[model samples]
Target: MQHLETMPRGLPKAVKKCLEKSRDSALLAVETYNKPAIKFKSGGYIVLMVISWTALFHAIFFRQKKKPFYKKNNRFEKKDGDYCYWELSTCVSKYFVADTNNPIRKNLEFFIPLRNMVEHKSIPEIDSDIFAECQAMLLNYDKIMLKEFGNKYCLRESLSFALQLYPSSKSLNNAIIANPSTKPIVDFIKAYRSGITTDIMNSGEYSFKAFLIQVANHQTKNTLPIQFVAYDKLDDTQKTNVNRVAALVKNKFVQVPVTNKDLLKPSVVVKKVQTALGNPKINKNGKEKDKFNMDTHTRCWKKYQVRPENGNENPELTKPEYCVYDQPNDTYLYTEDWSDYLIEEMAKEDEYNSLYE
Candidate 1:
């Protein structure tokens, strides 16, 4: 085994360590993803990729601001212990200006959930379906690395596309379609693709698009293979063809927009939570009170500490509103996101009861 040590000679120790760790995680993610024989390599890739991004942001925070990236919590206090810092997602969401729309955020949305799923169970051989995302992950990593550090430390030249044994796209598609084992993987890809915006789905920057076309012979020995022409760079005829293909694909996987208007009433939110918990109702003060009822939701509003009840008094309490209260209507309008959160939490409670109660 090769001897290894972190050398924080010239740079700040935290910054150096974070950068090194990020690069190591990214390289390992790519390597694990490429090895087809590796079981659940996708999970390894996603976990490491997320760690890489988290560490990257940590390094950036230290390098730019010259302070520790983590935040302190009074709960974890000890005489000699250090304060806890934010995780990658929290750091990015809290500090990063690219929260609205960026390749890094877009890529993370997919990989983070994937990391969660794969942590619970093994994912079958379906990495090829998300080839674009995997490719973009590395690309975005290098882009950020170059921007944060410099061209001297860029890893672009060190990496290349993983060579596949079977280049037949038709055969691969057919196999995925026919195989029972791959059904969940296909469904996941389609569902994920359909949820995003048209531009995001098509953006090569967000997810690198590569069309595998068969070629008979090379034009020249010196001329490099694997030509990638952007949609804007294409000629009129080529652009028309690309548009047609995009339309066809879009039609098949219709995009479902997730808007705030899909928000649920407090009653709906209560019903969902109650149903998820499988709790019918309980007698309370000569009236039926659901175990996961409006009161429960009210408690959740206080517990989760996201939606502010007194937005009118202290608007700062609802800085980022997940639920809006309509004073005129005298009702709380909880977002679909809030409803989902409640349901997930309720389900977890139910599972805990079933397991331990």
Candidate 2:
């Protein structure tokens, strides 16, 4: 700083003055923002940095400027006041404020009378009836919207309700087609409710049940809830898994294959378990004359795969050859019991002795 001061002036006086002006302008930009008076004023006037206070006060507050807030509607009377009331009344009438058909535009002419009565010094006080109308108008709008849309969208499990209403109708929306084509339903319903797509299904973003209810009434005009088709068909264990999956997601209405139509086929379970198990000939290859032995196949099948209950087919484990027991001890035990391990070891010993002889 001392060196800068001591250095000979590098330019003529005019140039130095220009540099000083530039520096002063830059410093003033920051310094004024931190000034105490500008920060503390509580008047209605907002502080702005574009102009100096002396200029801003003269231009903004002293001038008493008011820009137009609404466009003049030609149908209304020839005054801004007439249009202002019309707009407010229109908003209220269309909302939960009144019956769906209340005459909002007609009421625009009356707000002037209402405002003038109590507010202006010479005007008479507003009647209690006039005051009550405005108050009631404000209260009913929220009640109306909530009741109208909120009640319509509850999701139903059975296609019976939706099938009655959708698909065949030409105007059906994509949301109503809650089939595999319209996405997994759970994800779409969630996005509709929370207005956010999320990985965490139940992260307090939106309630799944609430979302389905909305979709049933508003968004998914044609589709039924995913769960209703065959909930009764799920065994207790499968039902429990469905409940667990529902609890983890943002929306509980998953297209979980709970119905017999949706339940994973035995072949699907076999394929999945086969990858986890050594390729034991548990299920017979299609058209292979001999099916896999029952004791070995059932033992292997039960370890990794669950048997489908009731009307489901599991030909791999159910074939007659698949039921054979080499040594019958109990009626159920063939080659599958704990004793099979002991018995097999003894058989190996006998074979080894025969070869040695």
For model 1, where is the 10-residue window of minimal lDDT?
Answer: 1-10
Prediction 1 TM-score vs. true: 0.58
Q: How many pairs of residues collide in model 1?
A: 1
Give the residue spans of candidate 2 off by over 4 A.
1-86, 89-112, 122-135, 144-357
Which model scores highest in TM-score?
1
Model 2 — which ten-residue stretch has the worst lDDT?
41-50
lDDT per residue as tens, model 1, 111-164: 765666667556545555566687788778888878887774556666776787
lDDT against true structure, model 1: 0.65
Candidates' lDDT values, in order? 0.65, 0.28
Q: What is the C-alpha RMSD of each candidate to the true structure, in Å?
A: 13.3, 32.1
Q: How many residue pairs clash in each candidate?
A: 1, 12
